[model samples]
Target chain A: MKIEKTEHFLNFCCEMGRHLVQSGAEIYRVEDSITRLMHAYGYTDIEVFAIPSCIILNIMHEDHNYTKSIRIRSSAIALDKLDKLNNLCRRVCRETPDIDTCFAQLREITSAPLYSELVSYLAHGFVAVFFTLFWGGTALDAVIAFASGLAVKFANTTLGRMNTNIFFTNVCSSMLMASVPLALQYLGLNIHIDMIIIGAIMLLVPGIAITNVMRDMIAGDFLTAMSKLTEVLIISLALAIGIALPMGAARMFLGVM
Target chain B: MLRFLPCLYAFIACASFCYIFQVRKPRFIFLCSLNGAISWLVYLLTDFLPVEAARYFLATIAVSALAEILARALKAPATIFLVIGIIPLVPGGGLYYTMDYLISGDFAMFTAKGLQTAAAAGAIAAGASMVTSLVRMLTWRKQAHAQS
Candidate 1:
């Protein structure tokens, strides 16, 4: 009886984590790991948002029936649906997300509460920093700029399913950063294009597809990973061109030469 | 500090820019702030660090893993944190500079620098993926063993 209960819980955790990703949770990889832990617990029906991050799973050793190793393995990413609703209210004062309604919807979709959005932010920051030193400072500037823009595109596409205004996001940011060299010259901040490396470190923020591909690959879902990665490459290419187009145009028009 | 303002603001702008994509509800402002801080911190560290070449790889791993952990703890998705945090670290400008170099027919230096930057990026991914994938693979293998 205990084993069955445990199995059910494990399955539930993995399922919810999976759903979170499918529903476009930003932190799919984190969910992937949490679900894996859930699978180990033998809890086939693990509900994340319903409970807290810590869930106890007991391992039954056959040699001694009474003496079972009570392992308290914990899973993270507890959304606390109520908190999300409140947070939603604070953030969007005009239109609050109805907690009761959101919970009902969750029953159909099977996801965590909403706290995991914090984790997604960490992932974005990490990637942004990592890309900063790829080239000298000059090259780094442009890349950072693009990653910042791309982060939005990926975020919108994954979670909100909104258009994200990919085109202008890049144009505006790049246009701002493009003038780094010349603009600084006027203010006695005569820095080289290399100085912009820190500026461009955010350009190729590969959040959506990277997380998706990694999760799919880990789950033994090779097809999804491949497709997701291909999509990443395409998005990446588009992102590359976005900045390039504006920079190219500005130079020609301004006669930077 | 003032010199870094443009990059900083650009990073913030792009980091918050995701609200337009994810929910369009403005409910994600906190989410946006969190992402912005993480990504900005990483980018800023990379920018200020004295060790230019080798440290980039380490910084990438540090940032990515942090995002993963933060995601796990926050009950949100890793994408939220990672996406925002990654804003400050992309190398879009490098490709531009390299292309500009080529466009100007300064093939030798520009091409070489471009390749170097790409390689640096590869190094970052390779390091992070190695650890994350290995742990994941091992965790998976152990589970498969248990099931079988």
Candidate 2:
């Protein structure tokens, strides 16, 4: 029964993901997060997933990505949100005793903080360039690091739209990052360029902006994504300065190796 | 054998990834590798081009035009070729030098290399952009003439 529910939820999430992508929403972490939520609740069957899963999902998917100001709704409604989850779980469970499964499940649902996700892509790129030059890591590490960064950035930008209750993507990205130094070391490569490349690629989602700018220019959103991209470019320039200036200062003060 | 292959492969991968995002053409792969190899050669040259300024941006234009033509012929991404080719030119080392100097408190080396790198990147980007637009203009003119 549990297996059946899990299967249904997975199917639902996949369809929902495709639909979101089609509707032009950047639904990155939604699927993974939703699946983790289902796994937590121990609801592994289709009939059990019917209304409640859809309700939670529908609410989560309502807004994202065009950069509209987020509505600052009341925190008092958070319980109402949790109640929706509890009520849905109960309805789906349909008289299955041992509320232990439900409560235990709640504890397992995970989620990520936003600021980290926002910085991931740029970090990846910076590290990529860094590692290749100084530490002497090779191509494989660069690719893996950048891919992980992309996934993380996508998650960060889209996570809010995909139910904040689940946080799997953030953890996945962190784990990927933690593995970078180890990967570089395993190959017996110089650690400087090797690690920094992976780290830099963690943040290099440049192609996204490049493509978005072209599209916006062609599509005529002129003021929005382009202006936004300009703002992003300034921030990136700032971040680069932050990294470069401090190092530059130190070099002038100290002697080179 | 496999040592240089990593650099080559990384360039290819980066180019290919950009292509997937439709930033440029896939034939850009050959152009970038070809350009990178040339830049590598030029870096080895030291006589005609100064390692200081001319090396990074000059090699970039040669590769950009080459990749642009390859892109036109193959009907693929232009940026792909430029990006892949320029991979070899990325001042990964300069970045570290600046970082290391900063960490060790060596301001002089930091300032010197930092300005050089920022200038190199700017020069490369500027040159590549100009070459790409020029290529487009030439291509369009030829097409227009042919139509008549």
C-alpha DockQ for predicted model 1? 0.15
Among these predictions, the greatest lDDT belongs to 1
Candidate No. with top TM-score: 1
| Per-residue lDDT value at B44 in model 2 | 42
Please provide, for model 1 over A1-257, each residue's C-alpha lDDT reduced to its tens digit, 9 standing for 90 to 100: 34554444344334434444343442434344444444443334433221122222232333222111122222222223323432332332233233344335446433433434554554444333333333334443434434443454354335334434444444444444445444444445434443443334344345435544654565555654675577566655554555455445545675443
Tens-place lDDT digits, model 2, residues A182-242: 3444456444433543344324323233333433333344553455367445544433443
Q: Interface RMSD values for the candidates, listed in order?
A: 9.1, 13.4
Report the C-alpha lDDT of model 1 over B53-128, residue by residue, as the tens digit: 4454555565567755765565454445554454444455555667567556688978786887666555455544
Q: Write the per-residue lDDT of candidate 2 for residues B27-96, one digit (tens) a residue.
A: 4334555665665554445447545557666666676677677656754434444544555555545554
Give the CAPRI class of candidate 1.
incorrect
